[model samples]
Target: DSNNDLNDSEQEMVDIEYMGNNNDTDSLGEYDDTEVNVAGNESDDNDKLSETFDSLDEEQLLFDNGDNDTDDDEFMDDWTTDVIQSDCEIVCEQNMILVVLKKCRGLISMIKRSTILTLYFDAQRKRFKKALNLCYDVKSRWNSTYCMVNSFIVLREIIENLFSNKHQLHITQQQVKKLTNFELTSADWHVLLVLFSILKPFYLVTTAMSGRQYPSIGLAYYLLARLRNFLQQHNKKESLLEKRLKQLLLKKFLNYFDDENEQMELIMLHAYFDPAGFAALTEIERRSVEQTIKKSVADQASHSSISVANTLSITTTTANSENKPNANRNVKRNAMNLFNEFVGDIQYGENRENESKRAAIINEFYQYRKYVIEFNEKHEPDAGSVIVFWRTYGETFSILKGIAKKMLSTPATSVPSESCFSTSSALARKERARLSGEHPCSSVFLKDKIKL
Candidate 1:
């Protein structure tokens, strides 16, 4: 009864000018205080209340459903929640929501999520449920949290039923009262839908990068670029909650793809080498990457040639120093001339070889690009390994193959290495275990390398 009265009062306040003007208050107070509350003036008060309600109807007509203010005001009313007017306040509120989400991923809270999952999965087994199972989230994984939230959205009807049929669950009246907010309204669901849309791309990238068998680093640049583009595009169109989420995600994305970082070069090189990734990149990006690799290859070659020449000169000087000075001066001079001629020939041959290789590499790059583009245009995108593609064509493009080998060697993530260590730790978990250190190391190696 008290709750009903509270609702009625709140409804009435919606039409009331509770935010009274100071200037009007003095004019209104000029009237006798006793006259305002008299029985004779009761009709006047009722008329004023009716006029306020009439004005509210007019104001409500001005608010389109599409407007942010109208939607958020209705959303707040539905949830019995407060409106956050300032962008800063909204952002702070979103941050608090994120913190709450993290808390919800803790042990006890996860048990509740797991309960919902069990209910869904069991009901499906019983042929009574048509929805997917709710996923449990780990505190360390944002992807897992996204999955859980997504699952909740997908199976919202079933979850809503759980709270509705609280009697069946034997929930106490006090418990129901305390957990009332957990019953998500349509407005809450809409907010969650927005959140899911924003996080789905990030979830995809996380899944892609977590691969064990394939090269993930190659897709890193593409994925980051896609996410940045997605956030930028949606930042303006999104609601306050979604805008806050995009801002947070964009900041993180920019940090990961920072231009000054050494890893950026490594990622770009890997992406260039990956056939699928190369196809994904724009023409400009592909050209830039190719130029960078070519320059790097040339610098390496120059350095190796200089080192070889230095070593040869050092050997020649040592030999010349060991021989008698005057006795074999003429012989030494002749030997020096012959050595100089040999060195000149070697340098000339190397220069020619290097020039030919550089030309071949440049030509091969264009051919590869053209072939890949035409092939993609003619065919649907495949999810097969880029390493496999390069290996298949290794002989055809020898110089490109070399670059592929170098780039493909770079790991997309350190997960595999971390996993190996985790496996080793698991092997040593038994107290007073008699296993040798080498045995655990060997087991981890064979587990990863062994093909079934």
Candidate 2:
């Protein structure tokens, strides 16, 4: 029995050992399979990466070529080409352009003649006649004689066509002579003079008459003067009108009038009548104007003294100056000094209890008044009736004052006229064949500043 039992146990041990060997073999096979799968995946990933790099290289070359072509196109489209072309073609083309312009002028003139006659015959059209007359007057003054003459001729043709007059509208020699002898006084001439001065450089009249911006002579004059003064003060020489308005026509329009506070009208009146005698005004004249502006500003300050005093008094008491000892003391001392200086001359309302507030307000008013006087002294307005002028017209004078202040305060140099002219030359490049057109030239000139 013992011998049999031993055999059974030994057999059991042998069976266990065999099972362990089988399990080891299976694990080894699985490990080998995993290693083969990993190697294959790594090889495929390397191939994909190489392909992506190749694609990227091709794309970069295509982009570089495209960039070079775009740069070349931009270079060819520059103003140099235009200027060169213009130089080559100007002499030949100018005469031809002049002829076309003259023909167009003639057509415009004829239309004006028919319109004028029609308006003159109708009472309701009297305003239109006045505007037309104003337009002619301005054209005669600022425009070249050739333009005026051609325009008149065209006007006559248009009128003749419209009227279908078999016989000419006869005007006796005496009537023509009487019309030629019509005279305007200095004051009567002031309005037209100002209007022309503002409109001529800007070319606003042409723009407005074409029915752009309602085409009011008065409104155009006002806007032109304002824009001109603004530009002049900023040292901006370019005009806005040239950029727009090529072939506008007035179908219907609204009339614009100068309001009492219109600043441009005032400035224009001053420019026309006073003529900015800065070059010619004696020291005494300048002093007198300075005194007048000072007095006016002082009067305004005096009127507000009471409110100023109350404000100062309240601020002094309510402010917690103690928290910052040094700052508080300094502020208090300054306030006291200012109070003492103005208290005697300026009166405050009795109901106001705060003395410090009142003093501060008075000081501030005085300071503002002083600034205004100083401004007037540096940039005096042209002599005119102040009541008739608009407050908006003061913008030019104010801008002039600001520029002067900056020049005086800082070491920066003023912009030279030559710089502006150079910009104009570059922008207006006469060489560009396209720049020959008046409207196109104007547009380019206006935008020249942006390039700078």
Candidate 3:
């Protein structure tokens, strides 16, 4: 009905133009006054009608004319240019998109939001659906996948809001079906795999924790079995064999080895013989092993050395025992010589005001001198006794000496495990240049890599 009305309106405008040209206004003006006046009114009405029709024509011209071949070309050119310009803008602003992605990376919820926004902007409805489905799959496996799931829902809502009123622009189910069937590119698949890799350790941790008894050794065995199965499925025979050897070595150490208490030795053995098998140890166990090793070293050093004292002694020989006076005089002279030498080397003091402190110092020196004298007296007959003492007590003395040597050689005390944790933290935040102070669920995914 509207089409017919439009056609009739167009036809009426054409007829009015034809009649105006045929009936000259000048000739009509020269006729009788009554006739002239009526013709003048008709001309005025025609002029007003012509203006209205011109306006109508302008409005109709806004819609592309299907019948005109030339107009079709122009319409297509405009549409193509608009599309190309829009696509170019999208391409040009790709760096901005990357920046946004990086900025939103810290928080899991933010990452999810940004991903949805990117999908919406790209108009990838099918890809969006597939992403949502992936999130659902993850959630089905574990409810913690809610972050990704909520992101997908938010994206869907955004799409609906943007196109709800524009029926022609709406994303259809057919388009979504087509997109859902689209195969992921190799790079996309790799990214998904990396994400899965990140999640797997967390899954293992949760699974282990959920059990009635903490079966750490069993969990390790189960993990090893799973890895073997995966390797076999992938036809990785060499890797599977290597892993199997490591597991066997681990079983031998855990089941048959007697050094359970020597945790550092055990850790060293694991590092040397069964690198993969040591994953069975819990966090607490690992820490305990490290502390035990340090303490053992300290205790061994403490127990190894004997405390000894330094002393000096003197002896005198007398000649002519029958000549009592001369012999006595010679003995007295020898004793005097020894006393003078001893008094010159040793100093004893007393302070009336701080008598206790002075006495303590004197007593310590006296005890040391007495031990030295006794030791010298006992060994005076044997020249080889010094060598014998050194050889016999060498190990004990070396152990004592090692205490100071070790203290000096060791670097400033710092937890290497804690340093590793800080490094891991830095790696996690590299995608996010600034801290939002929000915790990420993906942090759990990094636990395996951060074991002490």
- Judging by TM-score against the true structure, name the best candidate: 1
Q: Considering only N, C-alpha and C atoms within 3 Å, which residue pairs clash in candidate 3?
A: 310-372, 311-372, 311-373, 312-372, 312-373
What ordering of candidates by TM-score runs from best to worst? 1, 3, 2
State each model's CA lDDT, in order.
Answer: 0.56, 0.34, 0.34
TM-score of each: 0.59, 0.19, 0.20
Give residue 64's lDDT in candidate 1 (0 to 100). 20
What lDDT would candidate 1 get against the real structure? 0.56
| Winner by lDDT between candidate 2 and candidate 1 | 1
Clashes of each: 1, 30, 5
Lowest-scoring 10 consecutive residues by lDDT in candidate 1? Answer: 11-20
Compose the digit string of candidate 1's lDDT tens values, residues 1-452: 54344323323212111222334333333222212222255566445434433333322222221122322221122422332234554457476555545422331132222222223223432332332444455434556657767766766665565556543322234334434545566656666687778778878877677666546467667666677788777535668777767777676567657644687766777887665667667778778888887888788778888888889878988887787576666554568787877766457756976797689879888878776666557545333456556656667786777777767766667876787788788876762375778666655655677788
- For candidate 3, lDDT tens digit of each residue in 1-452? 55456434432211101122213332333222211122235564335434434444332332223123222111111233312233433332334323332222212221122212222333332323222321212212422332332333345443343333222222234323322333233343333333334345545545553433331222233343344344334334334333443343344344433335563343332221111222434546544543544455444433432111121122112234444665465454578788887775332321232344334434533443344345545554222332343344434432322332332222111333455578889976784664545545443466577768
lDDT value, residue 63 of candidate 3: 23
Please give the distance, in angstroms, between residue 59's alpha carbon in candidate 3 and its true position after superposition.
28
Worst 10 residues of 3 by lDDT: 13-22
